[model samples]
Target: MKMLKMLSVVFLSAMIFTACNDDNTTNGKGKASIYITDAPIDDDNVAAVIISVNSVEANGPEGWETIDEFEEPVDIDLLSYQNGEAFLLTENEMDAGTYSEVRLILNIQEKVNDQIQNEGSYIEYLDGSKEPLFVPSGGQSGYKAKGEFTIPVGGVVGVTLDFDVRKAVVKAGNSGNFILKPTIRLIANQDAAMINGHFEPDNLDSAGYNKVVAFAYENDTFTESETNEPAEGEIRFPNAVTSSVIIGGDFTLAFMKSGTYDLYFASYDENGGYVELIGSYQDVTLEAGTKLELDLELNLLN
Candidate 1:
């Protein structure tokens, strides 16, 4: 059902956009750009999700005018960019106005008799195995994230697309084929916020944590027992808006809108299984363009 709903959103704006010749056209225009980021997937075995992007476009006077064009499709490792980190997809000038949506033209592959075509998009595993990350009927068109951003006269505006890989990558029922449903959002860079913090490393005296995942749930809505697994395609923290993987005692929950949230920390086993809820804090509010910091003490697990 989730995959169906996601595909429905994709089909609504899956039109194709052609390449545009660059005239170096920038005079009395506003600078508009797009960035790409991701949320951590809850699978420990997977090393990366690679996607090839040809160009990025915005909805404007010419239907889909290419703002930034690449000579060759760039392969991006989505996992390498997360936790407030983003890759600049494009940066160019446009006439000052409101744009409806951003389209990322992915160079996808065609499947022939259950075999994938040349390297379109695929997943890399820790043990050196790769499999096609299929996007249904996505090769012939574009995928989009809908949002509104206005460019001021002679001003610059940046929008970041947050790709939630946890919800976007799903396996076919008993088939082992992974599909990408493209759950994404566009946030103006000036209006984005984040919660970042450092964890005091505590070697649990021979029972140390293997992995930790941080979640920013709706304010006052997180529960200790939400860590229990639900259905197959869903995770425990249903109300979580964003998540981050704690790396080297640092974690950042990025691309969040200004709102109150409850931050929760939990430990995961090597296989990404929920081990236990480490701790949580309530009523943490964020304002636009601010990075709130919280220093987690080591005694939270006691």
Candidate 2:
């Protein structure tokens, strides 16, 4: 009878020990989040940059198993700021395991069709949502996080991705006579290797209806054709004509390693009877990752 009692006591102690260990270890999961701010941006209305986290997994014996098993929140927001100011929040707990890869997707949601009617024409493309944009590359498909990162179990980490508004544009819908131009905005990263610029066409179109007006604005001020003078720029409003439209070279800019920059393009006559404002911007990393082109358009009703 004494021997039987001792066996029962040993089994009960083992069960208690197992429960304690399970409580101490992390369930295996982490969190990620980020946003953008308009630093020294002249405009009051600023767009928000969105961040997304997905495809979280480990590189251990189990392979790339989803962390769906964890019950905690996977995304965290540290804080937010107005204009040049911003804040961030970090997740207090992270999976206590070593991870091989963590994939993240970034994008911006802007209201399309917002327009200011100039002259008698309704020359505006406003009110719609842009497709999801991938960072490091302005692709319809979200870009991938390059190098590998590891998350310590139950530890917290915060990451910030700064995007300049200078490189964003609004694309208008078709179904109109004249093709309207896009409004331009510029955003620059101090360490960014590329900058955006624009130029005006030197000649008219095949229809011989060459009433084109181009302007390059800096810091909300307009200037004449100064393509080769100081800031070096070029442009071709009616880029492609029905029978034949001249092709102007690309508008590329070499930027300072670290500093602020801004530039934009607006055209009076695009093609046929259309007024267009097309602008191309991109999210540039210090390394030459990828260049994104935002082709925004608008049409005027005469």
The TM-scores of all predictions, comma-separated, are 0.81, 0.27
How much is 39 displaced in model 2, in angstroms? Answer: 3.8
Model 2, 237: alpha-carbon shift in Å?
22
Best by lDDT: 1
Which parts of model 1 are misplaced by more than 4 Å?
1-28, 60-63, 111-118, 203-207, 221-226, 298-302
User: Per-prediction RMSD in angstroms?
Assistant: 8.9, 22.1
lDDT of 2 by residue, 1-302 (tens): 00111112211111111121333344654432222222111122323323333323323335553432223322322112322232332223344444444232222222235532122111111233223321322112222222233443433333223222222222223522222122211122222233322222332333233332222222323233332222212133212100011135133332223222233333333333324433322222223212222222222111
Ten-residue stretch with the least lDDT total in model 2: 1-10
Alpha-carbon lDDT of model 2: 0.27
Per-model CA lDDT versus the true structure: 0.73, 0.27
RMSD of 1: 8.9
Top candidate, metric TM-score: 1
